[model samples]
Target: MLDFNRRLFLGLAAGGAAAARFGAARAAELRPHEKELYEAAKKEGQLTWYTGQYQAEPSEAIGRGFTTRFPGVEVNVVRSTSQVAFQRLSQDMRAGVAQCDVFSSTDHSHLAFLKQNERLMPYKPQNAAGLIKAAQQAADPDGYFQVTYLGLFLMGRRSDQVSEADAPKSWKELLDPKWRGKVAVGHPGYSGAITSWCLAMRKLYGWDYFKALEKNQPQIGRSSADPVTMLNAGERQIGAAIPSATTLLSISRGNPITMIYPTDGTLMVPAPSGALKNGPHPNAAKLFMEYMTSPAYYEATRPFFSESLRPEVPPPPGSRPLDEVTMITADPDELERDGQEVKELWRDTFGV
Candidate 1:
């Protein structure tokens, strides 16, 4: 017992020493302001992130990258679809548990709702200035939230099943009887990206558009990323509103799927991240908000084909720049006001 105690003590001491050295080494890589933030964050030790941005793989990769750059601070990533994440966050809030430090959601309305309820911490990240104009425009004027991620909600198809010449060229093409039962889509009630896409479609083609789409009997998944999986598996030949980044990531893996920028316009989904008002790790949350806007965050996400928030960073290869694309964007105000109505409309139309 004595020997065991001595060994355990030595092991713990060595681990502590290694952690100290790692933190010091990483701190050397930071700028003065970042170093200062890192010092405070290190004291907090970790931050819990509730994200509906990327799926688990890329989300966890970003978390790991942050830890590598800020050694003493760990990231606890809780990933889910937008509505689900929001529901979980709501549960935490109602329980008075400060479980989530940072909340990143694909639904802009979520941030607006949080800001309105005063549940979000108002903080302007210094690195936010480096964001591109579009991202800046999407940020909350009062700094309750900032756009941290961007993706195009576009169409895609299984190359093995659909020929380029025969594939859909516009959103309207999916409504044709020829593609009935072959269309895949995500549930707006579950995914914020899908909610935005629904709004964009409603704006463009009216509620009759979804009424027409429903006639074709589309397969509905919980998350926008699920369409990519369905397309890859040949479970669905065409994805009606797949996230461009997730589609590109699958394509890069040699999946037999091809992204198709709808001739009408691609919907650009701006995902925002904000610190929680009653988080356990406020300093760490602030540090994370800063990290999300930094170039390192872009670098970590670039390989996954996520659109860069900073102008200095280029889009991934094979991905078109936002300026070059005919993009459709939703207003946060509209989304905040009509999000629930759209969700209900979707449920009424699809019976899901």
Candidate 2:
């Protein structure tokens, strides 16, 4: 059996001869044992990935990294909101078209639906054993889908512009008069992170929290990612609810931002990955699943500001480990049941 530990994963950072075939470039290497899978994937030469975990930019970057690591395998990334991606997959399946090789979504409910229908391919990778135990436990035990990415809705602020003394330390602080015009947030309807955050908030603080926030006139963006850009540009001093990954990624780029994990607790959502059962590129899809779970994939796509799946590769600076942070997760069943109702309430209260 081949080990997919940090050492082996790092070694495969530059692929073997198969990867070198593309150019004089440093190829993405596969394990000596994986040569067979590599050859098989080479035959398929392509895959289409549908994802709602990241926006187009980082999504494409991850795809590019995948192709770089495994030469001759081209990846076409189709990215949109979680619900939108799910709808696309449903349409393709219903139409009898195999348009996606893999599907990733921020909405946990989607995984349950796909798994129940037996639409997801079940081939657990050896690399999966290296994932964090908490996240691993959250994976579909039957192997229909696995937790691939994670993000949290935490407060963020322009550290340079917002003094530490004045910055909000908790979610309720954002409602203070001092933060009236300085706050920004993601729309619950469009962002799975925000949807989870809103749902969790309603459970913890009730709908009144959102109603009170409305009086502060918070600027609402489409997704949790938007507040990162908004805060970076100084359009808003504080992102009331943005992806912790987005904030950390920005700070890494030297943005004057600081992730503020609320005293109350943050809303962390774990996104899942699944290979489509009838995907056109089965071999590539399986291999890609291995890559997604491997440390090599983490090395290839560090821009993700991810909570490391494996303890070997730690999360970026200035963020608490998922286990260390105070987190509130929305129930997948609850989201499936009440997501629409929360979104409706959001629009009515915020008028966004």
* Leading candidate by lDDT: 1
Each prediction's whole-model lDDT (CA): 0.84, 0.77
lDDT of 2 by residue, 1-352 (tens): 1111233223222222222243222234567645777799999999999998987777888888888778899999998878778889999988989989999989887878888888899878767876656556778888888888866678988888988888889887887887788898888777777888888888877899898888888888887788889998889999977877777778878899988888888776778899989999999998888888877666555556655555556455566644455666787778778888998999899887
TM-score of each: 0.91, 0.86
User: Clashing pairs in model 1?
Assistant: none
Each model's RMSD to truth, in Å? 13.2, 7.6
Candidate 2 wrongly placed segments (more than 4 Å): 1-33, 321-324
- lDDT at 315 for candidate 2? 56
Q: Candidate 1's C-alpha lDDT?
A: 0.84
Q: Give residue 50's error in model 1 in angstroms.
A: 0.4
Across residues 38-142, which tens digit of lDDT does each residue of candidate 1 receive? 999999999999999998999999999999999989999999998999999999888988899999999988888889899999999998886655566668899
Determine which window of 10 residues in candidate 2 has minimal summed lDDT.
Answer: 1-10
Which TM-score value belongs to model 1?
Answer: 0.91
Off by over 4 Å in 1: 1-28
